[model samples]
Target: MADPRSQVEHEEEDGASAGELLIEACRRNNTDLLADVISSCGGEEKAAEVLNNTKTVLGNYIYHEAALRGNYEVIDMLLDQEGFECDPINTREGDTPLHSAIRFINSLPPTPPSPDNEPSAAYNLISMMLEAGSDASIRNKANLTAVQLLDPRNVELKRLFQEAAEEAEREREIAGLEAEEHEEEALEDDYAGSGSDSDFDPEEFKRQQEEKKKELAELKAAKAEA
Candidate 1:
């Protein structure tokens, strides 16, 4: 992995960035460079942080750049990392990466889509985003989700979004169940550390009672003599 530290320092002195290498890697489908630089920076999660924090000139996140460029492998690299934000809205357009991908497809010249071609590059991109738990219901500044922006004639994309939405819900449900199970387990461990009155041993109780009675009898005798 090429250390970007020196490049960063040089850029600082001249107020010129060395260029966005990760974006370039995605642009060229260079996963090896992507993995090298990311792993070199840190592990998956740390690399995700660095990439997500950096944006294009358009103020779009790394995911946005990858999706717009139709870089599936790059998107997978970033999205597979833990704690990635799949649905990132660009500052200028208030459009999530899904919306960006959709808009890119919509802008293409009209063509007769078939099952052989209905799942266009745009469909695949949006599907990937949605599968990663992107919220399809989230509205942009225009109060439209990415699905809403689609041409009514494009039934394929709409149905794909619908499936993605369902898959996202299932993912959320599973996550919720896992969290609940963890909470329940913690509660059980906490309770196990705290014994109830019923937990007292009979033999220990009898021994304690006998000792207390003996002490009381001695105290009463001493008081009477006094």
Candidate 2:
């Protein structure tokens, strides 16, 4: 029989190999290789842990590396990972993957419009990241948000990011209103259940008011007489 110690060592080596492959797969936008690496990770939980925790010497996560290269397929797959973080900050520039993506787009030379008028791959990639919950408003160490980092001449991309930010703001407002409504309802329910009104007597309340008014009138008259 194989020794247990040797078996464990082999598994460790396999895991390390798979991790290195994962990074390469992301960098190269190799979805097939990435999928294979995920399978080799032994399970979903392990895959997620590896995907989330893997970082380069420069502190870029796999997601950041993929975004920096405009690797749409790899980014899409990474986003689908059960516990993958959409906005992990890299230590180098404190930039989230979204920021890295914008930087990549900004670096590219201008291209002519597509004949079909379909969005460009960069547009699609950034859109997917936004849809996956990457915050466009998150600022990096230089204090520049992803939207702000966008190339000004790229009006189409600017509009895309602006619309996303607006939509996110609207969603937040709606959520805030919903939370307030729920809070108000809860307070109403608590007030109803508190029994404070159960023993209330309208007649007693009116009588007490009248008594207070009469006392005030008498005091005023005595002061006038004096």
Candidate 3:
């Protein structure tokens, strides 16, 4: 028998291809085919043209598809393409892509998995989008950010996005610190380790490490108590 995915792929090819096809490909998580179409059709520019023709915007296109389907590859593709704006205010609703992504994340049905699989695909996608530069502060037509669009009744999605944003911020901060420390170390090495090779601040380093250990211990205790 013919493979089911192949049959679907054939049908897509036979139909009149357009931006909607691209969107559908994203929704279906068909990254390879999506990339091919986008590349052949001039990528972001062609996508922008489709948006113009459809009276839509690139942000809307990406937000709707990726948000609804938890398609991280598509979201990353859209985010990485330079000059494609995502945080634009919606003309009608005044909603930004961030708002849409949050709304869609909240709407997704929960699919619990065994330990190996993630409990939520939406969480991962949201995290990816944020890391890719989706603005967490952009508000929607309702004067709400994606965080606000989350139903209070569904606290989990709200917490998920919040945690993702916080985690992204933490990662960025850690990277910056690491870079700064590396630069400082490079500078020290440039000094040729001459001015007292014992200039290394062992006390400061130990203090910082001790603080980290204390924080980890507190966290572990909290988790254990919970």
Best by lDDT: 2
Minimum summed lDDT over a 10-residue window in model 3 is located at 1-10
lDDT of 3 by residue, 55-144 (tens): 234344444655555667776776665455555454556676666666666666655554775546666666666666667777666777
> Which digits, one per residue and each the tens of the lDDT, describe model 1 over residues 132-223?
77777879889898899887777778888776666555556556655655665565556557755556564665575566556555555544
- What local lDDT does model 2 show for residue 17? 64
Q: What is the C-alpha lDDT of each candidate?
A: 0.66, 0.78, 0.59
Error of 3 at 203 (Å): 24
Candidate 2 lDDT, 1-226, residue by residue in tens: 1111111111444456655777789899999999987888788877777787777767787888999999988998998988777888888888999999999999999988899998988889888999999988889999999988888888888989878876766566556655655665575567567756566554665575566556555555544553
Off by over 4 Å in 3: 1-20, 41-59, 110-119, 153-156, 163-226
